[model samples]
Target: MTATQPAAEAPETAGETFDSLNPATDEVVGTYPVHTREEVEAAVERAREAARWWASLGFDGRAERLRRWKGVLTRRLAQLCTVVRDETGKPVADAQLESVLGIEHIAWAGKHARKVLGKQRRASGLLMANQAATVEYQPLGVVGVIGPWNYPVFTPLGSITYALAAGNAVVFKPSEYTPGVGKWLVEAFEQVVPEAPVLQLITGFGETGAALTKAGVDKIAFTGSTATGKKIMAAAAETLTPVVIEAGGKDPVLVDADADLDAAADATVWGAFSNSGQTCVGVERVYVHERVHDEFVAKVVEKSKDVRGGSDAAAQYGPMTMPSQLAVVRRHITDALARGGKALIGGVDAVGDRFAQPTVLVDVPEDSEAVREETFGPTVTIAKVRDMDEAVDKANATRYGLGSTVFSKRRGVELAQRLRTGMTAINAPLSFTGIASLPFGGVGDSGFGRIHGPEGLREFARSKAIARQRYTAPIALTTFTRKEKTDALVAKLITVLHGKR
Candidate 1:
């Protein structure tokens, strides 16, 4: 769950192209065309036509094609991982993990689309018992998807795969930094869906994304910073297009007094530093019970010592995928130090040009930028609270409520229910994202709407409700020939049936 707007760069004109570079080595990974508005509109038009044909294939027909696409992705998983590592500078294993999750989503969406979206009878109340009611989710024509660079495959596919399974054609504009990965995915999809341009790709920076939002697509699914998400929503409002925005987060981890200190420390280390702390739902702040705060901090510091970032296989994590993000990490560390926070491990110097070493800070002020803002780096702040109540209060104080973790031997679920977040993991880190059946999203500044599971399949569809008259009412209340006594009878019936309640 990581997404952000592209870094500042020179504007592009029509027919222009840009190169994606390896973040760690600064080598050209791939060059892609900067799709202009005209191009984007053309793609949307194509998708509009494709959507008809795609939807013509009923659930079984679409599911069969989706399975074929899934097989292609499975067979070429290694190749896709290489492209992911090359563009994003993540370790191969990390890329593989992301790709596997994406594949799992494709499989789940295809298999469950019928059961989740098929037409079904709906209950008719006593007043409407004479009518037969039913509802079904129908495709919403062409969908526009603006993806993020971090977790490029998984994050975008969260929308793309589900949209396809829901019977809507898609026009995907992947982040400029990871356009190659997007292109690879689109081409692979073409292998199985060659009859039409069901899933098209457009590449560029913000301009291209803006065009996509205005391309007359039925809906837009955007994954990025809250600021960018706001911009997307504003643009979509011009056409009254519905949107699903999966944005940033300032996730927290709460440790109870009876928690397993070792397990909590290990989860913190991995949750904070993995992917160089670029995860949207990753652990950014920790609130531990006063009884175990000191011990937990010490264990986190000891465990994070070996977690270093580099481009090598031996490195625990990779370099910052976006070079501009390094300055943000450095600023957060500097602010924490300037505010009298103590670094138990790496300090300001840990944030190098590309790779940011894991840094653990204690005694950081809750009002400070490091604790309040979304650092999106490999850094975390540990603060002690008087009890679980205080911990929950502090954890829910942030404006961004995306994901969180709770470590407790006895009150795991009890405490997890108290945090005001979209999802929470008990005794684990990011467990919700791994489950294909769970809905993933957030509220407030973390953005709105969800992707994944039945909700995700419905996200790309429009509900169609139907009601048919089954029989004439014995009271004859709706007929013009009804007598005045009929009204009196209905009034008496209403008094007897609902007046009491």
Candidate 2:
């Protein structure tokens, strides 16, 4: 596709072809380019050359280019939003919001990359006082990013912006369902740096993602379901390439009895059904203090009924981006209901072809797969806990720890910190993505290696420490001249510093 054209289809150079079908209606939304191994290798080779030039620009020059790119996005905001809407089957407002967030991230990354990645002087130990030690971050040549269908813009930009600001060229393989969004981003970058393909796009299915992992890129950044993330890590291992996986999450939100029922209800509704519940950090489970459990559930049910999904203007959201996700969502809702669970809002039939209506299940057993696994649909399982301690225990029981939230007046921060996840927001859902300074990632099965903030900058660059002796010392142990006393002194210092009291 040309820069002037809407990225309705992936470029022909990528070779294979696939279709993006609307989940609401089983119609072909558009066709996408399927990249092969050969094309991926070529793209990586081109990115390597682009990386050198981009790196040579230094931090300041790159920041300027990034700023210009941001301006381009800001100017053509409408056009970009249209592509996102077309490719992902989301509402135009949702598309605009996603793009706006991506622009913010790019701006933040560009403005802060130098401060986060530049050289810094470090302290030399007393024994090595003569040595001047400094540490600097260097780029990792090229990065291959495999993005997911949900939150295509925000999710991929988390990696893309950081990698670009850190001086590495990126070859992004957006989810087949949202290639247009990916293409739009790359085209906008060309407005500021048109000399080379510093940021390129490749679209295909799992095979293409596999090709990218094995295509000799320095690192891989992937965002998808946990099962798929595991497969990606396994593939990356074959080449010994480092990877950052933003896998799926069964994120839970807890509400204490003292919390405001109205606020908790509002948060739960938006958190569970936003984007048709396709978010990686979307709230999939809820544990309310028994004191307010009944009130919270009724309020949430009432609020959810007002939230609708369709291809209309007043609808809160649009259809699901992918068709296959419908089956998974259905299976989970069914399993929960079959295990003596009750649906306060939607039941098994909520899974529609193009959109899964908001589903809030209660009385689901903890051991049920619906409770333990990730259900990346517009669904949630609400349960009551006797107190905060039980809520904490249940929240931390999951293997996946990505993000969590707490709605408590007195113990918000303390409770948030206790959760075994990379990030938690007090009385907010997915706020960490907005604060560009805080590290955003997951742990255990949720995946690792931050993609935003300082942690993100360091993730794309390697540390290079340099220590030089400013002057020769009197005790030159390495020279082997009169070193007996020096060796004894070194032994004594080690014993004094390291020995048990």
Candidate 3:
């Protein structure tokens, strides 16, 4: 949430505290303060002051500081990965991959902010040819970031890095499941920019997040479930604060008849099961052309045979980071199997207390719970389509349009363009996420607003346009002293130029 008025004074201390637990072991990872609304108000007030000093540094100064902070993250990458693994139960390699992607966003935001948000000349219309026009993006002062636990580093930094680069101080509220990672990031940032509290951390459960919305920041960048996004929006409306929501997605993949069967199978398996299929953009439903449907299914099942989920080095993935999600996953799987779906890999039995194996279903109805709602687990459903046209129609039928993939040797780009998603990958799985130059977001129920590339830099900024007269016009239409003849001439000019069109 963004602030519109001065913040209230804060209390001396928060009322209570909470602990972060490891999902796999159910052990305490760390304990953090449960900040109250008053405490949240204090953080925002301090951030408001810090934003002023940060904005004064200008683009070059801010970029230099951000690069130094990036260096800290790069040098201590392994240590950070360990923290992520412990809290989220993800494999260390997966944690490192996400962190590395976050580092890329930092580099991109630092290197490109000046060029993207700096003032630039613009062409004045023919009617105002005597005036010079220019536009520049200014920071929104203080930004509030509510981060998600999955890919905690990469997803949140997509917003945090851009907000910082656009010259605003950020107040981050990491999910209760991943507070240590957030603390580590904020601490690293402080080491590089110790002059002020440019980045602040608030940790706790739903109450803390609710406090943040009422704390009166300039804008809020949230990444989580669609239900939570709606709540954030409703809270932000009280102050008319702007928000950017990157919510959950029941993404789909389209396999055209021309697609490479082996490649499509490998991509689908990896995209659907990676990170134990907890990824917001991970593939939940796959649409295969009838010609290669049997081949693709066989290949996917073969590839998924060795993929296991456990908290160990040898395991391909790790346990479910959120324990409660196991029931939801189980319910979806049970419903699918009961509704005439056949499991190609794991089934309802695969879902355990801590982890769930990759479950692939075929012959599932399009209206089943597994297909229509977000399972948010290591599960996917495959459906055969008569042609590419049918495949696309089935893919677009869902309410979510966050991310999608198209596997076609020839029609990759064409098919990708037709999907109503924020980002798409052609002939590959989740490739758009690694590219720093592309913007990442979603549409419809998946939530809206972007947080990468030029669009991201502008998300935390307010555009200001300026026009100034360079010289006096021969005919002064704007002046009060303009003659009736001049007005008649202006009307005649408009008629000659625009009347026919």
Candidate 4:
């Protein structure tokens, strides 16, 4: 049993299991099985068998099936949203947004797989002149995914959709906090691919996740915190399996002197509080040019005061999905205020039994824990910068390099690129999360490997370079032929063609 397990869980047991809960009220949402090593190995064996069938379909057939799966998701969106809200205690609208974004990724990956993963030519270099060269992406047998509680659909769907489009069978182990959301998605997928178990669900805690990483699956796609990502990578390394890690983010937004203050304020509030701030790419720090820091801070504070977490239409946010998170939230806020930070809007009282009210802080030291660490709550730290360069410096100072935003009327794109992060959006917040054509992942402690666009397709598939010579070359270098004279002649020819004048 892991920290997420209920208190009634038996002490130190194997093969025992339990149910997932509704975070809002602690009700049993669904029963889940804690698979043993034997069961996990068997699931891998089954997945391998299913992967072969799936890969045999090639791009066209797989794309067609994925299209139907998308249609299934589209038609039954409301029912899925209900499950998402129940499991995670997020607003239904937020759940719907995640579902819609996931649907877009599924459609995009399906529609674009062939172009992204199809065979292509490559230069083999002068040393291998006798060889013809090409490369193509191939399925990596089966892939396992360990997902997170926030954005349960969109986050894991980023890997699942791309993996399926790339022709790999997937075994998904969603966060214990949102197992029902995972099960619902898997069941819906089954309706489209009724003849196969291309997508399998295994439910449990960290042990289940560890089993997946250690399984014979060729790769693992993990989305969680940096601490757990390290553990997953270490486990996968036992099998020398490749892993894609979408870990935590202490992402920052830089507001330039020339930026739009109002848009930046709205983006900051939403980016910080959506999902009650459980997003990996959610904004945690704000570095504003001193010329407009006061105005920007005031505007964001005003907007944040209106956002509340509940199951109602007026609620723009939702409760903390995991109870233990309440403690972590409390700690980060307390440490920030202790270090001279001032809560412009919400404070310690904002965190309640269920929801964490949107909290905004300013006048915090740059080196404070709140500014440097990922709070993963509905909190944002505002800091002033002497100039845009200082703003970028402060934003890039953290260990996380996931998603970053820049609000610059004149320098948005340039600033976005300069930040040491995987994806950066200009003017708006988390726009990269909405675009299917852009690859989503991060570097440094945030994690490596990609989850969307061409990079995503390649991540799920392996490059199988096929080089079939059009005909035997007159000069054969691969065999023990009379090649002394041939080698001399070839060297001379190469010098004549390639020596710089």
Candidate 5:
């Protein structure tokens, strides 16, 4: 792909910087220099050169380097978790879980990249019988990854690991709220591939990210809000840079009449309130069969009472990572209540200054903001549906179709197949995210392209096809000396071989 025109270097004041603040407390977590467009391009230029070196290392060589990096991550897992906790204000355990998941992806990408992307024999059509064909995936040079703060380590590595495995150097621009975690990752890479700029980090506000999009990177993999994704797509369009967007989602959960009520309630509470409900694939809406609606609601209410958000180790969840999000959570709950919804658990008041208590709202109008928009907080709205068909319909009605869950004993797979989303977990909450082999992404408003498994490896790669002539044909097809009779014979042969079709 051709590089974009040089980004106009924006002027900056000397010593301009930004502070990463802890959401749990109004304390500065870390301070980072505000990188400018010039700096971003310089990083990309270095990455382009580094990409050549990395790709030349080949699969085995690159895999070895990746293994070393993975070892570093494992040895320092606890230390990395501390940075994640300090930046995002999540529990230390949650941070550890995200880091462990990220390590797993690195392992999977290193072990499977060659098998999934290396050249392989491809079938030649009947007309090309004399030709041998093969296809392989090649790196897309340098890639820019703009990641989200929620699950900062696990979410961004979903792209970074695959891009590296596919042989592309990466320039990651993590969310400003979690720059400390990003810095930690880049610093750790130095302990492994210390000689090359294989994985670099650039920190700043949105302008820095925008500058990265306009930079001459070969591709951009972004995971963030739908609105921000649109802006990224537009900026990348200026250079025709390929992009893989993992945007916001208003995922749903379906509770069938035959579902295990106990399990369904438990999964719903955890799925909706985990990480303070900052997950892109979290369950924001619940559709229950009318027969078991009352029972499911009661169970969820009971399960949610114990789910509280605080900065302490004993808290089940943590505060909203982005303090501004508190207002949005409060507004969603207020709207749901004003629309005649009943708060069975925490109400609008539950959205505190730093932490948002697990709030469950029922009887909320389907078209209300709480149900319609992406309320990325620890809040869920449950609605009773006439049947499974209605449940599926309501689940598919939303513009955002990311991840969803279905609780059914017999019809688990059936309901999962009907819903339009990237992934679905049946009778469990968020099991897909743990599986490194499954592709992770969504369609429509949730954005397109994947970031895990084989699909992810291909997302940052370009498919190259090769056709070699194994033997000369008796009848020449591409020679100036070929006669008209030869052409007729070829046409007749094709007619006999495929005309009936």
Candidate 6:
């Protein structure tokens, strides 16, 4: 994934800078400073002070500021989308969709933070009836956010919005490929919160991100490849700083025998080819029941015929955001063909210099690189399964379990629940990502912790438990004055309450 790799490196000398280019034409979009470790530490220190004031605003006050920020994003939506497209080489419409989704998340986080993290009463249990137990999620002060280039606006804000809502100041380190987008976002936030730098932007290569992990931030929220996520975890471990890693995913799509073949085919094509298959949750593999495998493949190939990658107005998608990924896509296609896979649509020739035409493969071995690795390109491998059971098994075989999709009217939810992934979309492509209330993360190699919904807000917070003594108990078990009879009475109570179960 490009998230884990540095798009470009700057010189180590002071005052060095780098340029962000449009992958389509190699045109310089913008130039940004290569923030050094010293600069990163300085930003963290500034965030520390800002965090105090930001948290003091309380949920309601902070929410108001966020609302204003949301308005800025909405009003300037087209501008940000242009910046996104210029840097990422994605279509303007795709960039707009990404920005709109990011705005929705900001609104949701701001509106619901109080209800999710504010102090709330907790059950005290029978033995502690006289005490009032309460718990609240408190801010972790400052947070370091290492964002990815793909879906730069939406993916990074998944962490930034939630962290801010949880009352933490954020220092975002966007990918070097899309520093212009990052700068735009930070400037928008500054318009609303001019008093303090609640959200800051630091642009550079992987070293800047590494600096953030060790900068003494309370927690680090990273979105990238599992390989890079591991390196970040190791760096964060030096200071025992906590982290929430949203890593790479080789997501799958399952098409059942009784599924709506048309709908499944449409979803598979869009999920695999949209954003040129740069999405972390995009479908990379498909498992279809033998009964409908041929029909489904035909529909997918037919539907994919019109989908092309280019910079033209009619193009469905755009070129590869990172030039290096072009080789990986070609390698996967070449390896699949070598292992007896048949290309139903575009083949190795589809991978051009900047753009990769949508490619669909069949009869591919399950252990092939195209099936097992994170291709992260506009390519998908379709495999036949005897039944839905095999479909589920094959889908769950990958080390990366980030997301999955199912197309079965009757077993949509059933099969979705059985998949070893963090999220699933039933008869839809990337549906979980649009819902602000749903938590998004993955198990196993996809990385740990969450970055959306209430879980996301809590990820940047620490739970503070409080038990207030409202009145003295007749028999205080916690007190040194407790009698042996009290212990006997507690044992009897426990037996009566739980022994039956």
lDDT of 2 at 360: 90
Cα deviation of 57 in candidate 2 (Å)?
A: 0.3
Comparing 4 and 6 by lDDT, which wins? 6
Residue 47 of model 1: what lDDT?
80
Task: Kindly list the per-residue Cα lDDT of model 1 for residues 180-293, writing each as its tens digit.
Answer: 999899889888877778888889999999999998999999999999999999999999999999999999999999999999999999999999999999999999999999
TM-score of each: 0.96, 0.95, 0.97, 0.94, 0.96, 0.96
TM-score comparison, 1 vs 3, better candidate: 3
**Deviation of model 2 at 494, angstroms:** 5.1
lDDT of 4 by residue, 1-501 (tens): 122222211112355778788877888978777876666767777778778888988999999999999999999999999999988988888899999999999999999999999988899776666678999999998999899988899999999999999999888889988888888888888777766677888888898889888879989999998999999999988889999999999999999999999999999999999999988999899999999989998899888878887756688877898888888888889988998889998889989888898889998898887888889999999999999999888888888899999999998888888999999999988999999999999999999999999999999998897877766777777788656998898889889879869
- In candidate 6, which residue pairs get closer than 3 Å at backbone N, Cα or C atoms, i.e. clash? none
Backbone clashes, candidate 4: 0
Q: What TM-score would you give candidate 6 relative to the actual structure?
A: 0.96
Candidate 1, which segments miss by more than 4 Å at Cα? Answer: 1-14, 479-482
Q: Write the per-residue lDDT of candidate 5 for residues 1-501, one digit (tens) a residue.
A: 112222212223366799999889969989888899998888898888778888988999889988988899999999999999999999999999989999999999999999999999999987788999999999999999999999999999999999999999999999999999998998888667766787888889899999999999999999999999999999999999999999999999999999999999999998899999999999899999999999999999999988899988789988899989999999999999998999999998898889999899999998999999999999999999999999999999999989999999999999999999999999999899999999999999999999999999999899999999999877777889999998898899989988995
Q: Local error of candidate 1 at 223, Å?
A: 0.4
- Which lDDT values do the candidates have, in the order given? 0.92, 0.87, 0.91, 0.88, 0.92, 0.92
TM-score of 1: 0.96
lDDT of 4 at 15: 57
lDDT of candidate 3 at residue 486, scale 0 to 100: 90
| Model 3 lDDT, residue 29, Cα | 87
RMSD of each: 4.9, 3.2, 3.3, 5.3, 3.7, 4.8
Looking at candidate 3, the ten consecutive residues that score lowest on lDDT are 1-10
Q: Is candidate 3 or candidate 4 better by TM-score?
A: 3
